[model samples]
Target: MSATRLTVGWVPLTDVAVLIAAAERGFAAREGLDLVPVREASWANTRDKLVFGHFDAAHMLAPLAVATTLGLGHVALPLVAPFMFNLGGNAVTVSRPLAAALAAHGGLTGDLADAGAALGAVARERLAAGQGPLTFAAVFPFSTHAYQLRLLFLAAGLDPERDVRLVVVPPPFMVDALRRGLVDGFCVGSPWNSVAVDQGVGTILLLGNAIVPRAPEKVLAVPAERAQAPEIAALIRALAAAAAWCATPENRADLAALLAEPRHLDAPAEVVRRTLDGALVIDGAGTVRSDPDFLLLGANRPEPRQADWLADAMVAAGHLPQDAGNAARAVFRADLYDAALAARTRG
Candidate 1:
């Protein structure tokens, strides 16, 4: 078969499992595709490459596709996410001193509500003490990490904008930023948080699942015109197959090793294994917490509910206009996912 050629842009996080596997495993070949998975330096670079024809599709954050549709951060190019790669794979990590402070002040816990309420109290104390608000970093203005942290603060009655400052720090530099006190805490996707904790410079406070269970994280995104192409289905099926392989217990170590290659995440295999198994090593003492369903790389479906919630969060955060809800639905392309997966199931 003459395979269709396509290039995909991706960052080096574990969430790029689908893209990596599709190309590295036999999935892409089986799908009649010459899939070139390109590693990008940053999310912005990934987005720009996808938007500027450098890539045919991308391993993209779900919220970034919605925000791109509404022209929130960059050019108003309508992107479509026909398959969500996975869900629930982000974490909020804070500097050890900050974590210690929160713990000492009756705020630190595994429970989201209890931890959030505790953090809210700490935020108030920082303000009262004439110290600047604690800084929190997210990868981008339109990322799930930002949304997760925002939701955590909102639920606890803390104003995310006023009580604490939110900043943008690329995932690779997140640990360094925290270590240097450039940011007190950060919400970033896996591998990075594990790296931070492994380095003993940071402590993970909450997993994204704890904040909002099964919240959409990454997706397979392309320009709207390509969403319905026949190859789109092939690629979707390939990605779904890759994700299924990645979720298997025996493949976890292999996945970590593949991801730890120099061009990929470049982190320790042990750290990547922890994330794959949903067992986070939280502190310098190597305390591991088993978090069930950390990464939802299950049946391939992009739920509109997630797009709606993300759009609503964007609106609430003043990143998008009121009409963003409508844009999110158009951008998410749940129907396309159904069409592709259903066709694959029939075959």
Candidate 2:
């Protein structure tokens, strides 16, 4: 019999490794699933397409699921994330010009406090000079990337709304935007940050973990109505297998190769390696870090807290109401996760 084909949407980030791993490692095949990984433009597009039924499920931003569940984005079709794909693959990178200004003020290597203070000084100088407000980019308005960026600015006593301009730029064009001076800085996921540093168009300001430790990244999100399907269960199980394999240090190189597929990132294997290995790259400085910090699609990876935290982020960002906790939990689908973990443990 032919395998059941399922379409899974994903943005072009290194953290979406579970979807790629399941496809490349034959785990999906073993589960009798033909997973067609659809590449999306932006988080908003991914969420909209998934809600409209253009996608069966997606590698979604955690906040988008909570927002959709609360009808914040219009049409509250509940969605659930049974597994987290990965974590801590994001960074805040400033354009070369902005980096130069910050460097001139002090340097990029300063701790988070100093970095924010330097940027604030720059923002003030620009304001006094009667120049336009400095603009920054984030992947989505409701994403952790955005909120984290805002929090970082706030921690430095810079008002995100008044001192700097925050806009949504597609991840693929972040480097180009920096090169063209369209934006001063961006908070985006890996490969893009590595790509920017490699191209010499941008400099890394801080890692996502530096801003917020143990941050939730991507998740295997599905519409709540579709969670009843046996195929969805199988996909979650296959994701578990792929996550188990990916969590092994021996599989790191192989996982990097899969991410380097021409149709996917097509970035250098070394860049992908650093991303998977959680090494910090500052102006192309490759320093090995012990954290790796990636939350693969696994039972141990704080999947429930991922939901709670994401929902809280959505509420914080004004995408969802704070009282929608019950509704948010309904969409996180811990039962599906429990089932997937049981199967993984049994076999």
Candidate 3:
């Protein structure tokens, strides 16, 4: 019999490692699946393509999945996440001038609260001096990155809505946006932040974990109606196997090289490697910050609490109404994940 072919959409980021590994390392083939991973430039494109049936599944933002299922921003499409791609793989980067301004205020201080206070001070100074608010970019409105930024602002005693401006910039375009002075800073996933740092246009202000420790970042989201399909189960099994492979420290170097291919992230292997290892280059001055929990990828099954957490965050950020109910929490199909892995073991 021929292998089952499935098209999966993804944005170019280190968290897409599992999907890339499954396609490149023969894990999908082992399960009679031919996984075609399509690289997208932005989270919106990925979500739209997936919802429009251009993709069988997608590497999607956890909050976006929740929001989509709840029919918040776009058309109400039932989406379900059976597998989690990763946790905590994002950072905040500020333009060189913004970094200087932050330093003058009080410095980063390696503390999120202290850093937020300093940022609030700078934003206030800018406003008091008749300057516009500092604009920050995030990948998408319904993303952890945006929520993290909100948390940073709240920590600094500033209103995310009124004190500063937040805009959506495609991850790949963040470096250019910073360099061109279109944005003062941005919160984005790996390789992009490193890319900005490498170009000497930005300095890393804080890792995503600093704002929300071990927050669920991306997931393998499929149409809710197709959640029970045999192919989806097989794909889940393949992804589980691939994610385990990606978690092994010995396999990361090869994985990083694979992710750096033109068809994937099309970034430098060293930068991808650094991101996978949680040893990121933060600035042009060669400041390397290492955090083992920076980006975790390994057999992460979707859980209901994670969905609830995202929904709560959406409400907190005013993206979702308080009466939105808990329907979104059902979008995470942990039962499907459990069954798929169990079937794999039985086989």
Candidate 4:
């Protein structure tokens, strides 16, 4: 007589689209599901809640899932993602003061490599002048945001750990943190970077796609046993359809409306619109860059190759002791996606 109720967790970010659309647009309802999305303050909160059984699934950072399963940053709990929600929707932003410094030191080049090289030069100069390493924040220790930031520094021949202080800051608070001088720069998913630019607190450095194009972003993550639930297929299908809807240009306005709900991203539809369209306003003065593949949804799947890539980066960044190959493959669960989608096709 009643729809199946399932509680899930998500942070306030642009990539939470599929989940919100699935629930709000009746996709979850058609699947006989009453999806309850619980808002979380941070990725750590989402991970902890999932482990504590407070969530049936979570819109989670891809690497956080692998990290949890591999015991890299949390208690070992093998999670699986049958569906990846989106890919490559992140950016690096620096405070106005730091942006000015970087610009003055030739760090504002549009090229990722040239920019990083110039930033490395500035970092060296600041350190020699006793300013030491600049502080940079990411949403999670084990997220693509972190790895992408490190890779940007790596390309410049500057060690991320030595040239900058890495820290964790929640997405909703990134702009304020940068404004307050808590962090000099941050690598975060949309539309937080847009929010910072809109607020005039930070200047966009580079989109994450410049560092790792098509980098895996969020996934629909659940514990190992939950992956086997019969309802997972319908749920994932609904989300996949929702992702397709979000990817449509005609639906951008509506999609932005869905995400701009008071309890969801809670930001301006215009800002959300820019992020969805990849027409990013890189600075407060309104410079725009059109990046069509800034975020991939719709046909996005949980690829083990993505997991393996992130795992290798984690090890290289000294976040993991070993390769975590097996753990990554297990958690990625492309097999589950194949099975679920196949069953849906058969039906």
Candidate 5:
């Protein structure tokens, strides 16, 4: 008889490339595992389902796993991130009006400290004129995008909580929100950022790299209890190997095509290519830059040290303790990652 299959849930996003690669490239099948990729409508839905044991594993926001593990925000569970999927694909964007206001405030350039002061100045001016506090959107409260937005505001000397409203809007509606004047700006992963710019509804403010510099963005999180099962363990090992395969340059193009399938992102191949190649158009100007290091897949580097930084952002945004470093690191599960690496290499 065939082994019992495992179901994994994922939010449709470009960074989810590794999961798609594993499913489509026969990596999961070779591990004697039946991997079912379920599409999720929202981050909240994905997290809740995982917490309810409806999902065996999931592609989760790195911070969400940390936050959930620590009971910092809402639900607490023993979540384990066995592998990091990708890094550095988030971008902060502003509506045309907000972008114009920021540009007029002295060109949105400089270190976080300088940007913080400039943003504060803009906020002060808006308040004096009796304008509404600016609003921004991110995928989730504990997501990298939220942290990146907070970092940008802090550098501009604006208190994220008091100075503006930070809200959660799903990725698919990001451009619409910007276009409708519902949010002044947002921080989201690609290709939403690229989508907004391409649709001419928003301006790219800063890349996530500018806020934290090659931060850990996403992780392959499995329930801690189930991860101990032998079949699940074997699947995890194969996933690690697939990630390693994706790290090679020659394989990226093929991976991109696979990710563009209707069952996957269903976005244009060019958009996927732009995401991988980092061909960006700045502030509606059709100039492109060659940024090959846009998203790191199956990276041959240390696991993204995201927990502390993510918790720090939570603290900065008033969601958790100011010094949540120790609590945050508890759930990262780097040991599992190392073991998976060993399994892949030994095979």
Candidate 6:
């Protein structure tokens, strides 16, 4: 019998590692799936393509998946996440000048609360001095990166809407945007933050886990109607196998090399490896910070609480109304994930 051919969309980021591994390392093939991993430049393009049927599934932001189902920012199309791609793979980075300003307020203490306090002081001082609000960029309006920024602002006691400027920039362009002074800081996933730090254009101020420990980041989103189809189940099992492979410490070097290919992240293998191992270089001065939970790929099961967290974040970010009850919970098909894995075991 011929394998089922499925087209999946993804942006070039470290978190998309599971999808890439499923395709490149024969996990999908083992499940009788011919996975076609299509690389996209931005999340909006990926979401649009998935919604328009250009993709069977996609590596999607957790919040974007909920927002799409709730029709918060776009046309109402129910999408469901049967498997989570990753958690806690994001970091906040600021330009060198901004870093210096923050240092002057109180050195970058590597603590999220301390950093927020220092940033709050600087933002207020800049406003009093007749300087415009410090600009920051996020990959998308409906992303953990955006929410992390809001959490930072709240910790600093600054209004995200009025005290600081938040804009959308593709992850790949974040470093350049900071370099050109288009934005003073950004919250993005690896290895872009590493790239910025390596180039001396930015400094890593805080990791995403600091704001929301082990926060759900990306998911494998598919049309809600097809959530239980056999092919989708097979895809989920394959991704689970692939994610397990990716989580093995011995396989990280090979995985990093595969992700460094020109068609994928197109970054240095060492940089990618460091990110996978959670030994990140935070600044140009060769400062290394390690955290095992920096990016958790092994535990890929979809959880309802993850959905609840995302919905709460959306509401807090003002992207969704407080009254938007439990609608987002339905978007994460944990039952489907469990069913797929159970079938795999039974078979």
| Top candidate by lDDT | 6
After superposition, which runs of candidate 6 have C-alpha atoms over 4 Å from their true positions? none
Q: On a 0 to 100 scale, what is the lDDT of residue 196 in model 6?
A: 93
State the lDDT of candidate 6 residue by residue for 112-155, as single tens digits.
88899999999999999999899999999999999999999998
Native-referenced Cα lDDT, model 2: 0.79
Cα RMSDs, all models = 1.5, 2.2, 1.1, 1.3, 2.3, 0.9
Residue 245, candidate 5: Cα error in Å is 3.2
Kindly give the stretch of ten consecutive residues in candidate 3 with the minimal lDDT sum.
102-111
Report the Cα lDDT for residue 244, model 3. Answer: 94
Candidate 4 local lDDT, 1-347, one digit each (tens) = 58888888999999899899999988888777888989998999999999989899999998888888777756888899899999889999999888888788677765688678777888888899998798899998888999988888887778876778899998899999999999999999999999999988999999888888899889888999878887787788778778888888999999998898788989999999999998999887789977898877775677768878877887887776684566677788778878877876887
Q: In model 1, where do residues sit more than 4 Å from their true spots?
A: 345-347
| TM per prediction | 0.96, 0.92, 0.98, 0.97, 0.91, 0.98
Taking the tens digit of each residue's C-alpha lDDT, what string does model 2 give over 67-117? 777677478778887777776678888887788888886747636777887
Write the residue-wise lDDT of candidate 1 on 1-347 in tens digits. 68899999998898887789889989989989999999886889999888888999998888888777667658977899989888888989989988988888565577887778778878888889999788999999888899888887886678887888999988899999998889999999998999999888998888888888888888888999787899988898888888899888898888889988888889998888888899999888888877868876764687778878888887888887886577777887878878877898898
Better of 2 and 4 by TM-score: 4
Q: Order of all candidates by TM-score, from best down to worst?
A: 6, 3, 4, 1, 2, 5
TM-score winner:
6
What lDDT tens digits, residue by residue, belong to model 5 across residues 1-347?
A: 58458778888788887777787788888887788878896788888888898988888888888777766656678777777788788878888777777778764563455556667788889988999788999999888888788777777667878888899998777888999999988988887877788888988777677677777888877777766677666767767767877777788688778877787777677777677777666568765644566677766222535666666766777777766666656666677767765776787
lDDT of 5 at 330: 62
Q: How high a TM-score does candidate 5 get?
A: 0.91
Which residue pairs clash in candidate 4? none
Better of 1 and 5 by lDDT: 1
Q: How many residue pairs clash per model?
A: 0, 0, 0, 0, 7, 0
lDDT value for model 6: 0.92
Q: Total clashes, candidate 1?
A: 0
